[model samples]
Each structure stands twice: as C-alpha cells, then as structure tokens.
Target: MDNNRLPQETLERVTEETDNLMANYNKYVEQLKESYTNAQKERKEFLSSGIEFTKLIESEETEEKILTVYESYKKLLDDRTSLSKNFLSEINSLLSLVDQQLLLLESSYEPKFGIQTQNPRIFKTNKNNPKRLRNPEDADGPQMNGKYCICNGPAYGDMIACDAFHIEIPWFHMECMGLFSAPRGNWLCPNCRPSE
Candidate 1:
C-alpha cells in the first residue's frame, strides 16, 4: 500500500466515529459528576437533619416537633440511598459503553495493518554443484563456477540474477548495489556491461 495516499473514506469514517464516542463519553462523565454532587448534597442534608433531631430530643422539645424532625431525617436518608443507587447504575452503563467502543475501534482498524503471511517457496537444490568453500587463500584464485555475486557471497537475501548469457558471478545482492527493489526489464551484472 502507498504510504502517501491512504483510503480517505476509511480515515474519515474512523475519525468521525471516534469523535462521536468521545463526545458520548464526556457526556456520561458529566452526568456522573452531577449524580455524585446530588448524592453528596443529599447526604449532607440527611446528616444536618439528624443533628437537628438530636438537638430537639436533648432540649425536651414537644413530641410532635420531634416526630416531624425524625420523619424528615428518614426521608433525606432514603433520598441519599436512592441517589447512590442511581450513581452506581450510571457507572456500570458508562463502563459497558467504554468496552463496546474499544471493541468497535479495534475491529475497525485491524484490517488496515494486520499481520499477513505469504506461502514459502520451495526451490530444488542440486547436490552435484554444492556451495563453494569460503577460504582466505581462495580469494586470489580463479573464479569458481559454483561461486556467485561480485562479493563472492552465498545466495541469500534479495539478489538479482544477471540476464546476460555469458556473465560470471551472475547473481548480485540488491543491497550491495543500493537498490530498494528489482528493476524493470532485463538487468546485467557489472562484469557483463560493455565499455562506454
């Protein structure tokens, strides 16, 4: 795939989806904050009312006033409990949505840069023409028929076989020649090139 030009539609769709998810996530966070604030406020109210009821009992206030204060305190406590339950339920929903969004994002981008494997190629080896021996003293000797490449290296990595009919050491490593990929049409090794 060309790095310069990715599929524009896919990029745009992923961006738009991510933005939408983020917006929803932020909204949920705001709701959780509001729920927490409301719960705290209810708790404070319940605590204050309990303090008032204790003061009324200690002062030997009228029975009717004491009962009224106690009832109000109980109602505040119930409201606090309900608010807590609602906060927990909203938290669960937010977590579930986050998990789903993660899954969606993973699935969306997996196909773009997923691991891919090519079937290995099996080549037939010739026992009669085994690999040439690599010895320091042999470097000065005449070129061996079994040896290959200008560097006299074994056939490994990316190499291009010369198309010339009567070329010596026909195979050349693409790296040694500073080539990123194979050239178009027939290619000749340095030894086979005609004089300028």
Candidate 2:
C-alpha cells in the first residue's frame, strides 16, 4: 500500500506538479498585467477626451454629469481590485492542493530505518504567544501556530531551521521533523519526540 508520503518518487511528482502550477500562475499574472495596461490606456483615453471632468465637477451646471463619470471610474477601480483578489485566491488554492498531496505522500512512505512507525510527534496549539507579542500579524506565521512546549517555544521557522510550511507540528523543530514526521497542525519537539 503506497501511503503517498514524501518518498523520492513522490518528491519528483511534487516537483513536477509544483512547476506546472507555477507556470499556470505566472500565465495568469501576465494576463493581470495586461489588464492593468489596458486600464491605463483607458484612463489616457478618458483624459484625452478633453472634457475635463474635474472642472465639470466644480461647475454646478455639469455637477450631475461629472458625478456620472466619477462613478464609472470608481467602478473600474473596484473591478480591478476584485480581479486581483480572484487571481490570488486561485493560485492559493492550487498551492494548498499541492501541500495536501505532499502530506499524503509523506504518510504513505515507510522509512527503511528498521523502526517503521507512524508519526510520533504531536504538537499542541499555543495561542498564548500571539496574545503576548505586540508584533505585526506575521507573528502568527505557521511556525508560531503550534502549542507551547520545549521545541515549540521559540526558534520556530527561521532559515537555520525548517521553513514555515515544512516545520513539524507541535514543536516545529529540525530534529523531530527527521524522526517522526509532523502532521499539518500537530508536531512535537525533536527533543521531546525522538525519530526512530
């Protein structure tokens, strides 16, 4: 039974899939850029009309007409904002799918190190950290999302250790990550939970 965890073959698949996803994402971004360019051109055309909508707004005689033009411009701005959000959400969903697939692949794998075992590291969520720190919202990066414990206390997802997304649950440390693979939200400290 292939568990579909992060086996070498699975890694290869992830690499391929991630590459394709990135390509598609890039294509969408290019289209978005094109949309921005078109918007700029449209703005230029509006200006070139020489109607001077700004002047029209100040003149009571054409205030209503000027307001109409302003509303149209506001609509375009709103549309662009909405389009950007949709594009971001689309890419985010694709990345999230890949993340889940990797988790499955990692679980299916049984390391050859004689100690064939399920994940032993279990993390608890420590909501206290965020409440204590007055730092920016990034304080809640994935590394800091786990419970309070020895490994999970500090040194979460710095470059010297695991990346934010790859950190083991609970503790989010390097050693535990090697031993018992971490589930998405559960992870024990490497010191507390030794790998087989």
Candidate 3:
C-alpha cells in the first residue's frame, strides 16, 4: 500500500466524497431529530385525544355539530389512509401536520377569516347589499348575487363564514391577481361567508 503512488485524481475524488458524506450525514441527523420530537408529541396527544374521540363515536351522541366535525376527521383520515403504505417514511409527517390542525381546532383558534362555527357569520348583508341566494336550490349556482359566493348572505363574498365588516360587491384583495367574477373562485375564503 504505497499512498504516495496513488493518483492525484483519485485522492481528490476521495476528498470530495468525504465532504459530501459529511454534509449528507448532518442533514439526515437534523431531519431525524425533528421527526422524532414531532412524532413523539403528536402520537402522545393523538393516542389520548383520539381515544376520547372514539368513545364519543360509540356512545349515543346528540350534538349534530360535533358529529359533523367527527365525520370530517373521518373523511380526512380516509383520504390520508392510502399514505399509510409509506408509514414512518412519509405518512407520519403528514399526520403530524393534520394533528396540529386538529389541535388548533380543539382550541377554537380562528384563522384570518375570523370564522366561528358557533355563531352564524354574515357578509355583504344590508339594505344596500345584494339579496341572499344561498338556499339549497341555488347553492351550486352563482351562490349569491352582486358579488361572488358569500356562502350565506348576499354579496357577502366567501368571508361571511364569520361575522365581519365587508364592502358590498367586487370584494377584491389588491394583492390578489385579476378580478373574481364567478361563484367565488378558489381564492375566495369559504370561512368569510356572512352568518349574520
């Protein structure tokens, strides 16, 4: 084994490989730490809260609102079930994210839209605002008149989900590109629907 006889190119290649290996090792270790901590916390909370949630399922429940919420979680779980095939490799990350969202819900945290499920939120509603057309029959249609779908009140726009002040018709966010002229395009906030 004559080190001096080794090709200069070969030595350079080994040095480069070593550096790459160290970088990758550092990245993997950081990722592992994050994964471990997040999983530990999420699993603990899920196991406890999920047990309570499950019990509510088996018992005779009368709260329609709670039942609806449970159903949404069931659906979310079902949608993400296929990811379980990847298990610890991928699904855990996604489940942790969903768990966080659910926890925020449990805390009744409101998004920027200020939507509260307990009380009806109204938008664009007033003598000057457009008339309401959120009835089941017109749900799939325009959803409202004068403005995009308010989800509940006239011209409320999508922000009506929680009560808040809103301009009548053509509620446009300046930063948002292009004018929204249909059934509250995808950018419209569903939570913004006026409930009052």
* Top TM-score hit: 2
Off by over 4 Å in 1: 1-6, 56-196
* Local error of candidate 1 at residue 49 (angstroms): 2.3
Q: Model 2, stretches more than 4 Å misplaced?
A: 3-9, 12-17, 45-65, 109-196
lDDT of 2 by residue, 1-196 (tens): 4443347666677678678767866876787687677667667655644376554445654655545555665666777787678767866876787677666765554432112223334333343444443333443233433453344455333212222344343234334345434446544345444569
In model 3, what lDDT does residue 80 have? 45
RMSD (Å) per prediction = 18.9, 14.2, 24.2
> Would you list the clashing residue pairs of candidate 1?
none
Q: Which ten-residue region of model 3 has the weakest summed lDDT?
A: 111-120
Whole-model lDDT, model 3: 0.42
Better of 1 and 2 by lDDT: 1
What would the per-residue lDDT of candidate 3 be over residues 94-170, giving only the tens digit for each residue? 44554554444434433222222322233222333344444535332223344543322333232323223453433
Q: Candidate 1 on 83-189: residue-level lDDT in tens?
A: 56765675676566555544544443422111111101111122244444355344222223457567876545555667788865655666766767667766777
Q: Assess each prediction's global lDDT (C-alpha) against the native.
A: 0.54, 0.51, 0.42
Please count the clashing residue pairs in each candidate, in the order shown: 0, 20, 18
**Which prediction has more favorable lDDT, 1 or 3?**
1
